[model samples]
Target: MTERTFDSATSGPIVLGLSLPVGSVRVQVIESLITARVVLHTDDSTGPAADAVNRARSEQNGQVFGIEVPDMPNGVIVRGDRGTVVQSVGNMSFVGGTVRINGRVVSGGMGNMPTVSPIEATVCLPAGSSFGLAGTSADAEVFGYVDRMEFRSVSGDLDADGVRQLTANTTSGDINVGRVTEQITAHSVSGDIEVRLYDGSAATLNTTSGDIEMQATGAASGHVSAHSISGDVRLAGARHLSVSADSVSSRIRR
Candidate 1:
């Protein structure tokens, strides 16, 4: 296991990013500090898995901070800057490309080696910070309040709490959020979507074959839309809002 800490007071509003192929990530918001702890969950800690964990690099460009792990020799590129962060991993290959962070080379070339083991990361950021993630089969959990949160995954579940703006996209992974204050947009193919204690003004939740459930609190007075093709749509405590709910071949209950 490896741990790193950063001072959030000097960086203003920090944007933390993580990229992993297969693992679980947990993020928590704190008062004024940032810490990241990573562990490789494998039996062979002295082999390539250990090397991957050792090679995990942390980069920062102004308020943007990120961690990049060369989990796969080929088909994985993780890069970030002050404006945006992009991370991709799988069987696809990008030839003649170099991965860089703030114009510094992280990985110059990709090898034809096998992928590494699963990694578990727990990160702590300050309040009102933003987070971005890109992964495959990496389940994520977020605690406390965040200014903005965005993630994209395949077969990885997301559980979050107290986010101002939330956007998530997943295939076959459930999405659950609590205490949203502003806006939320989520889409899943075969995973359930549930939101509780939502004071948000606008919400757009969609699923192909999964259920959609939402419960509003306080005086949420905007528009809420939920749709599912072959799953149930259940809503509660949303009397003061305009709701547009639909289901193709399933139940819609209010």
Candidate 2:
């Protein structure tokens, strides 16, 4: 018998702060807009969550946006929205589990914007947080803008489209993005980097020993570049591509 519950509030903002005693479960972040609203498909029905939901509902620590009992446990998806901002603070025993952002930002709605509106979502998993991409689809629309994003200690894949600016700092994980306007800066002491740009965007990828992959060519006038300590570089289907190999051990080609 799976147990679950939902406790939500209109904080005028969405902020989820999870602090509990003992439990083994996964958390997902999701967003909704338009007619095809987003839902949190959880496996746990409403048993294990009754206590937590009721307690939280009775508390006054912070504001709650939306809740789902039988929500998806593996990942939270923000669907059919124009300008929706999703964020989380991973504090469970699993630490900073995984985050999958597979949606688009529209305009003229509760969650809609043009250009990738700035993403102030800070998933600070410090010692146990991770992020990644679960799937890819053309169904996702790109109406709004992601102003900027700052990722820290995320242990999963980082995926997006039409990103204005982005920062990834993973102590142990990988970062993969697409369509960032200004820069895609990913620094991992131990991880890999992969950036595929459909529209030209500047990028700076650095890692200790993980390989770097950059594939973006849609009238992208920005320079394509990568940097690593003990990792190799690969480039394909690029226009006006330039090669500036630095290390004797590292290889660079156009």
lDDT of 2 by residue, 179-230 (tens): 6656667787667777766344566667777777776575555665567777
Q: Residue-wise lDDT of candidate 1 within 1-254, one digit each (tens)?
A: 33333333343468877776656788888776544333334433555545666677777777777777565443433221111112343333444586443444446443432334455677777777888877767778998888998888887888998788899999988999987888999999999999987888899999999999988887676999999999999988887789999999999988
Best by TM-score: 1
Residue 87, candidate 1: C-alpha displacement in angstroms? 16
In angstroms, give how far residue 106 of model 2 lies from its true place: 53
Clashing pairs in 1: none
| CA lDDT scores, all candidates in order | 0.73, 0.41
- Candidate 2: list runs displaced more than 4 Å: 1-147, 154-156, 160-162, 237-248
- C-alpha lDDT (0 to 100) for residue 190 of candidate 2: 62
Q: What TM-score do all the candidates reach, one by one?
A: 0.76, 0.45
Query: What's the lDDT of the predicted structure labeled candidate 2?
Result: 0.41
